[model samples]
Target: MRHGWEGAVLKLFRGKDFTFTVTGAEQVTERYRRVHFTDGGLLQTLGVHPTMWVRLWFDNAGKPHQRAYTLVDPDVEAGTFSLEFALHDGCASDWSRKAEPGDTIEATVQGTGFDVPDPLPPRMLVVGDPASLPAINSLLAVAPKLPATIWFETTHDSDDELPFRIEDHHDLRTVPRPKMVEQVKADLQELVTADTFVWIACDTTTTRELTSYVLKDLAVPKDRVKSLGYWKAA
Candidate 1:
């Protein structure tokens, strides 16, 4: 399928396209699904980076709509990876819900990159929702040695069942949706250090609010912070 204007813009910027074949799929929860894929030489060509993502093409009313999903458990040597979808009433979620082995999808790799902090932070303050779980995992996996305080805001009952890799030194706090931002603020007040690294991904409003707080109110330098809204709340 032609990707429409958005795809054209990405192509103008030299976005590389690839086809991914679904090797397997599983329902992680009623609200979530996991799909495994062979990267079609993507892993070997572009290599891998922390929190790497790709824009997946989906059909929305016969028009190509793209959604960005972070790569989960990317195995470069095997040229395989898995993507977890927080199911909802959307074309992307609909595709994932019915995805099975042998299904193929077109994807573009563009506007996805991650840069680790020049000097590892003394403390990590992470905030996110289920939509950003894969990214949170990738960031933590790349910096397991640093102590982290994770604020995971839960919207569905199954969110608590999601996997989190918490070491002895790491702290995980599952917050109700309404209280997430305040709780994170309270924690950051105590945890923010000269070299504290803050990461946030949630609904658009919350992400913007928290990003402003960290960069302005808390005085965290831009280089020490990373924030992006994974989805917009309706």
Candidate 2:
């Protein structure tokens, strides 16, 4: 299948193309699924980093569609990786819901990056939801020794079954969708300090608001905070 105009634009920006073969699939929760794949030489080519992700190309009635997914438990030597999907009403979710071994999918690598803070943060503050869970997991994997506090938003009861990486030193809170921003804001009013690294990935509006509070209200340095909108709330 051809990637169409979007692929053309990505290629113009030096995006590298690859094809992934599904090795297996599993259901983590009623609302979450995991698909395992052979990396199509992607891991060896560009190398790995914390919160690594790729743009997966899909067909929506013959038009090109793409979505970003974070790599889960990538093994460069074995050339394998996995992706976790937070099921929703969309083509990507539909694909993962029925994905099976032997299926192949096209993907592109572009605009994925991460840089660990120069002086390791004294504390890691993370705010995210199902859509960003895989990236949050990757970030935690990269800094296993750092103490972390995670505020995770859940929209469904099934979300409780989804596993989150946790260490004895980690503090985790699972909150519902309503007014999660307000709760997080109230909690962080006294938590922000000079030695904190704040990471946020959630719905667009919430990320924007929290980022503003972290930077403008709390005066945390931009370099110490990483923010991204994983999805747009509808």
Candidate 3:
């Protein structure tokens, strides 16, 4: 399948391409699924890092569509990893729902990297929804000992069953999409310190609003906070 212009742009930027074969799948919940894949040598070629993600190309009615997914449980030696999908109405979710053993998908790797803070922060403030849950889990995995306060927005009742790698040191709060931003703002001053690391991955609007508030209103240094809009609201 032709990747369209997006593939061309990525190629110009030196994006590495790979084809992943689906090994198996799991139904985590009514609204979520996990698809396991042989890495197609991606791990050996690119290495790995926390929150590592790759763009997957899917056929959308003969048109190319791509979505970024974070790698879950990546095993370097085995050249394997799993990607969790928060099932929704879209081409990416559709492909994930029907993916079976031996099914292959094209993937591109570019602009995916993370560097842990030199001196670990005393605390962490994180915000995300199901769409970014895998990345949230990855971030927390790297700092298992760090105390973290996480706000997860829920759109469906089944979202409660979404796999979250929260530890004893983590405080998790579930909020409706409408209340998430306000709740975070109300608690920000107390939770965010000068050295507190804040990571947010949500709908584009929410991510942008929270990032602006944290950086401008609270005067947090840009380097201390990581923000990414995982998806756009419909």
Candidate 4:
């Protein structure tokens, strides 16, 4: 039998050290940067397959931070992929801002098993903060032509740059940062129906809260709501 998309192993390229050169950077928002890597050999060695999740490890100054980010656009033919970073004054963000081309950084390869829904429901809910945007966007790209309700809670208005195609039945609602849970709760209460399937990603705290709301308050079936905790506050 052929291996399904879930079991593919992308190449795992080891850099000279835990440092990366900044080939290019684009300001998606005051708190986010779109960084591109140019080490073709490293990517090729890793055998990066489409839709695989890549985890980058680096130390800022002396502190270590491990961040999991997906490859935004993986061009196997060109040997390039984009990783979007949520800029924090923290170590990882500090290093990313200072990286330039020819710099080296250590990265690990991993695969994703989260299955996308089939025969999409009439309306669906996608909820998360900036960190979860990439996964949410990827999910949306392949979603069926049914209605979608997207609720994004961002730290700043500038951090609201989503580069995915939105169909006619898709609705995007943005609420300011620090209030992700509150805003998402409100949206779910008003918009969710018995048949709606909900996908949520965010910090640990918000994930727990949203999961409880969906499974307890709204009485949504366990299988209909999916929630993930991308990170925890320091």
Candidate with top lDDT is 3
* CA displacement after TM-score superposition, residue 200 of candidate 2 (Å): 0.5
Candidate 3 residue-wise lDDT, 32-134, digit = tens = 9999999999999999999999999999999999899999999999999999999989999999899999999999999899989757888778899999999
Worst 10 residues of 4 by lDDT: 1-10
Q: lDDT-based ranking, best first?
A: 3, 2, 1, 4
- lDDT tens per residue, model 4, 1-234: 111222133333222222234577787777777888754454566654323566576664554445678777766677676778788777678777876766666664444446555546678798877887777767676655767888887676576565555678789878776777887887788877767788888888888889999999999888888787888977
Residues 1-93 of candidate 1: C-alpha lDDT, one tens digit per residue? 999999999999999999999999998889988999999999999999998999999999999999889999999999999999999999999
Task: Write the number of the candidate with greater lDDT, choosing between 1 and 2.
Answer: 2
Relative to the true structure, how large is the alpha-carbon lDDT of every model?
Answer: 0.91, 0.92, 0.93, 0.69
lDDT of 2 by residue, 56-87 (tens): 98878778899999999999999999999999
Query: What's the lDDT of the predicted structure labeled candidate 2?
Result: 0.92
Reference-based TM-score of each model:
0.97, 0.97, 0.99, 0.77
Worst 10 residues of 1 by lDDT: 161-170
User: If ranked by TM-score, best first, what sequence of candidates would result?
Assistant: 3, 1, 2, 4
Error of 1 at 35 (Å): 0.3
- Candidate 4 at 10: error in angstroms? 15
| Regions of model 2 farther than 4 Å from truth | none
Pull out the clashing pairs in model 3.
Answer: none
Candidate with better TM-score, 1 vs 3: 3
